[model samples]
Target: MSDEPLRIVHCFRSPVGGIFRHVRDLAEAQTSAGHLVGIVCDSSTGGVHEDRLFEAIAPFLALGVTRTPMQRHIGFGDLAAARRTLGILHRMKADVLHGHGAKGGVYARLFGTSMRLGGRRVARLYSPHGGSLHYDPRTMTGRMFFALERMMERFGDGVLFVSDHERRTFINKIGEPRGRTTLVYNGLRDEEFVPVEAMQDAADFLYIGMMRDLKGPDLFIDALADTSRTTRLPVSAAMVGAGDDLPRYREQVRLLGLSDHVRFFDPMPARDAFRLARHVVVPSRAEAMPYIVLEALAATKPMIASMVGGIPEIFDEWRHGLVRPTVEQIAQKMREALDDPIQFAGLMPPAESLRARFSAGVMATAIERTYREALRRHS
Candidate 1:
């Protein structure tokens, strides 16, 4: 390890979703290891919950935070935004610029490239947490994004993938990256490994991710209705997250006449939310090793998750834990969990194994090593 702590800056688009969680864990780990860290992300995306998270993590961000109006798509206006982002990064003089999602990755690699050209010492690293990989390459939009991904790779010093599935998808969609690539699964803190028993009035099901289509919140609501009908029992669900599409999902619940059965809340700490329901439901259509999976597993909470992204990888040989993303498939699992959550819970990996494989300490050390490698090659 170097004598001094490295200055690290993380850039991403929305301050929500899996990307945001991943950065929070990584930032805490890095800070505890005596590193200086900062965050640069979109100001308008997250809400009051995220504001509290920023407050809790403020001490770690010695280089300070930069929240700007960042757009989702690449457009003429992005040129100005890029300049603004570059200005923030330049002022920080970050030793490593690590980007979390597509927009953040683009900014990090491009800005780091400019810093290198100016004889500045910096390393550019990217972790694609299934941001751009959800695109269907057969479509025109996919082609455009994949092409942009290829160009972005040229600017990257080291490419990090959260799962083997994400890495394979990147190679298939964007071609083999010329830069170094590494696989680092998401991790959890030791305290998270303890089992979490539900509260006395825990809901029958819980959906605790971003309230958006990509995460399949709509499917969760549909399956809850289906489960109630099939089982002939009134089932309740707690949807504990916030996103731009939350209003739309609320309308969906209203139209489906599930207002009484399904209750909504803004985002809260994952551990606290875990106690609100008997079983967690992660019905995402796409993912790249979601931290929620790791969190739930570490907490020894029984779960029903969709078989997308790196979720299957988490189960390892116990792939029976996965269900399809469709309403029918999720409903099937929901019924089973309702009937016998104890048996269903047996399918989860042991806490010891999960703790061994997905420790935050291990993840931070491995990522810091990658940063050092990138800095060494920063010519």
Candidate 2:
């Protein structure tokens, strides 16, 4: 491998949620380390909130940001999208094609392989980010995706997993990866470690993330209702983030008569959302080391999160405190936290511990080393 800076291009589908966060962190960190980085993602997904995020990182993207229409599922449209993506990658002259999710992984490996055929020495890397791994292997959709994952392994030089559970799920569902694999936990920045103080009129709880079922926004609402009824007291919350199911969640809150207590807001910075509530609740049904958990912990904000995916790994010794993603369980935990805030706060991992384990600097270094290794092997 050359000592010169590597030109890296990250390809992902949605420029929202954790995948986007991961890419932004990597792009900034990599750029600081003297590497040139770029981003390629779907243009049709994010709104003003995501636009703001892109603007913050645009200056660091040496290869620049490229967006195009990308369909969420397999279709004839993929052929056109893939061609466009391949063209973009070729033009960027990326030394490493790093894909962030299922769709991105497919594009990175396939497009990177196509480039290789034309005598390009690009290292193809894929990070699942709990994308297709969320499917059930027993179902037809799951089997099909797993099969594709197994096949795609051959086209990539390496697989990067954000959590151990993500890697295990891939092996259990699709069998052992044919290429090299690395487990790199998602990380947080130094400024993110600064605790966010609640406003004088902050809500009782905060649910920040996509307003979709998988993330358990519905469960959070039901738990809030359950908590209020059981305690015979009003419980207020702020739900942030945008999703297709936003209307459904709003309807759910109204139907449950929580319209007065629950407020919906547009997607904003996590720290900004954190200050709107005294406590955070992550009731995700599944995850791959969600950045929200790390962010909340680093911010020194007390929180209760479901034990799923790589969350257990994040919790580590504190994993015993995690609850299952259920209305009853989430409600019970909510009540517990509210009833005895001190005891609940004690369950949180120390900020110093989180900072030591999950930092943007560490994450970027490990990933850069992995890229170099892949390039060396391919060379």
Residue pairs in collision within model 1: none
Give me the displacement of residue 294 in model 1, in angstroms: 1.0
- Per-residue accuracy of model 1 over 170-233 as CA lDDT, tens digit each: 9999998888998888888888888888999999889999877999999999999888888888
By TM-score, who's the top model here? 2
Task: Report how far residue 144 has shifted in candidate 1, in Å.
Answer: 0.6
TM-score of every candidate relative to the true structure? 0.97, 0.98
Weakest 10 consecutive residues of candidate 1 by summed lDDT: 312-321
- Name model 1 segments beyond 4 Å from true: none
- The lDDT of model 2 is 0.92
